[model samples]
Target: MPTPSKISVVTERGQVSIPAQLRKELSLEKGQQLLWEKTGEHEIRVTVLPERKPRGAMAMLGFAKRFRQTRRTEDWMAELREGEK
Candidate 1:
């Protein structure tokens, strides 16, 4: 089934309000960033970029320290490969 389209009027300042239904459906939050691109002479596309989260080695620092390895690497690999036999 085709989804019905929603429309919004552009304001004098060129700002348009995203319809509440679409916003809720898309899970858009305040301060979310969107990318707008012109695909054709009269067509444009809007994409919602995934929310940015703090991610990097720094963010993962000390994460592995919380758990201790109980077995050697070789033992673990052998155990994993045993199922392949």
Candidate 2:
């Protein structure tokens, strides 16, 4: 198969819209991220990073789901106080 190439002009705000055909071919989306790297004096590499889900307050979801807690937070503090004696 042949590679498709095209030219685009950067807007006044330094933003360039990805060509519609390339976007569709690459499955690019509105909120997706693209990493730009300069490989040479005039060459810039565009890398498509994997999609990420922002966890926010639920960052610990599915983490340590099976870990058993041996003691409560208060119980641990009490043990530390006694060990100082």
Candidate 3:
């Protein structure tokens, strides 16, 4: 079965809303980016880019296995502070 076409109007600022049904089906979220490309004279392609994983603490999960720590937390902090003097 062919899916019915959806129509959207470009606003004065050139913004177009994606239909609710399609947004839900695609799992689109706010702040997500879309890639637009010109395919032909009258056609364009829009692709949903994969969401990027957050950096910092969340990105460091399970990273401890790669490097072993030999000193205690307090010892390490004290050593770092000693360098300031």
Candidate 4:
């Protein structure tokens, strides 16, 4: 995949405007949170993350629990051993 060459956003009252092309490509929507990092002089990185749902971590734990409940421990152990080869 080709990375975007250059992008610019206007700074207003200490807030920056994210470009529409980058926003759409990253699936960003209004009121979404973004993470920013400074790499070096005149360089910065921005990334868009999916919106987090309430109790999302609990839901993931539940998924793991249900999956483990349906699997035999011995079978899982065997698979793990095979993966070590």
Candidate 5:
């Protein structure tokens, strides 16, 4: 497997610098398209794809179902509050 890229955040703005090695590996260029999504409270997912669509709808739906199935009502309330912030 290829090694994951090391990335750094920009201090002045809420931007991140993707490592050169990873860019080259992914064939990313200055104007290449990318998608950014907040995967968790402390982590953001950045993916380079021509179309900014999730890989599979079924997987996403299944994940949502599993999440709802696992969470308590209080947990759902806490998540809603977190999103408001």
Candidate 6:
């Protein structure tokens, strides 16, 4: 695919604004996180980092509700090996 480029101006505090076209193409929203790296002397790479979210107490419950403790680890392994034979 052909890549599009746009000129950006860096602010006084070493900040650069991503253009609207690039933002729209990247589906960037307000308060999103970005990872930037200086790859070489004159080149930099940008990666989209996952958004940080605080998990509430309710969000932590019941994911593995069916989990149960086995009596022994060796028994579990034996059971798995039995199926292979």
Which model scores highest in lDDT? 3
TM-score of each model, in listed order: 0.60, 0.61, 0.61, 0.52, 0.50, 0.59
The model with the greater TM-score, 2 or 5, is 2
> Per-residue lDDT of 1-85 in model 1, one digit per residue for the tens?
5447988899999998998987888899999999999999988899999987678877787788789778899998999899889
The TM-score, computed over Cα atoms with residue i paired to residue i, of candidate 5 is 0.50
Worst 10 residues of 1 by lDDT: 1-10
lDDT of 6 by residue, 26-62 (tens): 8999989899999999888999888775579756687
Winner on lDDT between 1 and 3 is 3
Error of 6 at 26 (Å): 0.8
Write model 3 residue lDDT over 14-85, tens digit each, in one string.
999999988888899999999999999988889999999979999999888789878899999999999999
State each candidate's clash count: 0, 0, 0, 0, 0, 0
Query: By lDDT, is 1 or 5 better?
Result: 1
lDDT of each: 0.88, 0.88, 0.91, 0.76, 0.77, 0.84
Which regions in candidate 1 have their CA more than 4 angstroms from the true location? Answer: 55-85
Q: What TM value does model 4 have?
A: 0.52
Stretches off by above 4 angstroms in model 4 are 56-85
Of candidate 5, the 10-residue stretch with the lowest lDDT total is 58-67
- How well is each residue in 29-77 modelled by candidate 5, as lDDT tens digits? 7777888899998987888868455577644755656555666889999
Clashes of 6: 0
Where is model 2 poorest over a 10-residue stretch in terms of lDDT? 57-66
Which residue pairs clash in candidate 5?
Answer: none
